[model samples]
Target: MEKKTYIQAFCTIENNKIVLNGETVFESENTGFADFSKKAYQHFEIGYPKFFKMDNLSKLAFLGSELLLKAQNPNDENNTALLFANKSSSLDTDVKYQNSISDKENYFPSPAVFVYTLANICLGEISIRHQLKSENSFFIFDAFNAAFMADYANILIETQKAKNVLCGWTEFFGEDYKAFLYLVGNEGAIENTKQNLEILYNK
Candidate 1:
């Protein structure tokens, strides 16, 4: 018999609001992503100073991951694979890095900004924070690929390559941004299916 996989927890961050498991855990009045994200970080009381250094995309993904993985602390297993996707694919930071060198006369490029050019860096941030060292993957699609995400996560679980998979979509480009993160494992109230994934994502 095949083992059952479920969505242990899920989180979403967008519209200056942070939603976890269909509940609004945090909402900010700030209008800008930067300010709103920072305030959200402070509200969570996350002591990781490195969060402030990450690009906007990383910050967005990191926050959503933090909420989903908070009390679970799956770091003990060290086998939680990360799977993330985004439509913008780090364009927000690419634009920033591009502007730094756009003017040859005032050319100044910060390595900090350059490092997060890839969407996968957001996964790195989550891994570093949780001390996760399992196999991870990131994808770029026109929109949230719920079917692919569900199938991919289940493959990892069924293969026993990972005890659990932390996966979702983290999209941020300019002021437009949205992050939806979910944890997939052998135990939970919700089954890990494309329909359920889309339902949680749309929530």
Candidate 2:
């Protein structure tokens, strides 16, 4: 019998740096989903699917899923998505969507932009992209809550709602953006859990 080493992880934005898998890929320039997508495309070598550029939240969701899927246990199917965050709640798209309604000359809701008004849509996009149907939830908070995140994840696993969980905070502050994600599971490969999440935001 051996004590297992779990690798609980997170990605974040800081000092104009985009931290992903603990590596800084881009800097400054008001990075958002577009920047995230470009950097992700460069880093992963897999081009984004055809429709990513069509929507802001979809792009963010795609990026989050890409990171979480890499950390997921390939053998596990019972996985849940838990997201936490605050601010704007897709204000980026809301602004764009408003124009469609505001213009009396051709007032029409852009379904593309309208689809992202709810912050939780990001989760749906990710789930669909990954074919993940396990339990999923979204929470809005002023800051990251280590205790709540840990408890929720543990509950999901202990109750058999899922064997693994993808928990995260994804946000866009106008042109600026930040995202932190983790894969939590009973499997022996993830580490740090709540402590790792603290390091991400507290940094």
**Strongest candidate by TM-score:** 1
Best by lDDT: 1
Global local distance difference test of model 1: 0.89
For every model shown, what is its TM-score relative to the native structure?
Answer: 0.95, 0.79
lDDT of 1 by residue, 1-203 (tens): 26779998888888999988888999989679999998998999998999989999999988988887785854534888998998999899999899999999999999888999888998888888988888898999999999999889989989988989989799998899989998898888999998998888887
Which 10-residue window of candidate 1 scores lowest in summed lDDT?
68-77
Q: Could you tell me how far off, in angstroms, the CA of residue 154 lies in candidate 2 after the best superposition?
A: 1.6
Q: How many residue pairs in model 1 have overlapping backbones?
A: 0
Q: Whole-model Cα lDDT per candidate?
A: 0.89, 0.64
lDDT of 2 by residue, 46-127 (tens): 5546435446655655665676576666667446545455555777778888888997998989666677787878777777
